[model samples]
Target: MVTIRLARFGTKKRPYYHVVVTDSENPRDGRFLEQVGTYDPAKPIESARIDLSRVDHWVGVGAQTSTRVRHVLNDYRRATQAIA
Candidate 1:
């Protein structure tokens, strides 16, 4: 199953993540098909960057989002909405 999830990166203590499309069997931070976004917990939640168009395309093609990704997407959506 293809899934949309976060791949951990950055140095120890300082964490960063790439929102990627990959097979469910793949290990976290392992090989991935594509990176659709980025998350830096050190920054504000609104600062997370995601390509919503790509995300929608992936979702349309049956990609399931991880819980944390879903939460980030929701917060991003709210932030964008508020700015508009």
Candidate 2:
């Protein structure tokens, strides 16, 4: 089944990840359907940069985001909306 998840990349001690849409059976760093965004944990401050518009687009097209990805989206939405 197809799903959206993070794909590990980079070399040696430093690591990077790509937010990709791929098959569940594929390796974490293997082939994917599309690259939607990226995540960098090596920065002075940890951060995740996601294409929210693309994410919404994919979800609208019936692409299922992983639990982690959903959390990111949910957090962003909540923060932007400033719900009490």
Candidate 3:
């Protein structure tokens, strides 16, 4: 099954992630089909970015999002809503 998830990267003690679509059988940081966005815990909440359009597309096509990624997307929505 194809799923939307995070791919871990960055040096030890400093973590970064790419929100990607990949097969469920693949390893956490293994091969991915396409990157849709990024998550950097080190960055401020207001600065974190995601492409909701592509996310909607992937989910529409049957991509399931990870729990953490779902939270991040929610945060993005709330932040943007507050600004508008």
- The candidate that wins on lDDT is 1
Cα miss at 3, model 1 (Å)? 0.4
In terms of TM-score, the best-performing candidate is 1
lDDT of each: 0.94, 0.76, 0.88
For residues 1-65, write the lDDT of model 1, one tens digit per residue. 99999999999999999999999999998999999999998998788889999999999999999
**Distance from true position, residue 31, model 1, in Å?**
1.0
Every model's TM-score = 0.95, 0.69, 0.92
Q: Candidate 2 vs candidate 3: which has greater lDDT?
A: 3
- Tens-digit lDDT track of model 2 for 1-84: 778888878998888878898888999889998898777766521246677788778778888889977766666566555643
Q: How close is candidate 2 to the true structure, as a TM-score?
A: 0.69
Which 10-residue span in candidate 1 carries the lowest summed lDDT? Answer: 41-50
Q: What would the per-residue lDDT of candidate 3 be over residues 4-83, giving only the tens digit for each residue?
A: 88898899999998888999999999989989888898886568778889999989998898898888889988988898
Give candidate 3 misplaced runs (Cα > 4 Å): none
- What's the residue-level lDDT of 66 in candidate 3? 86
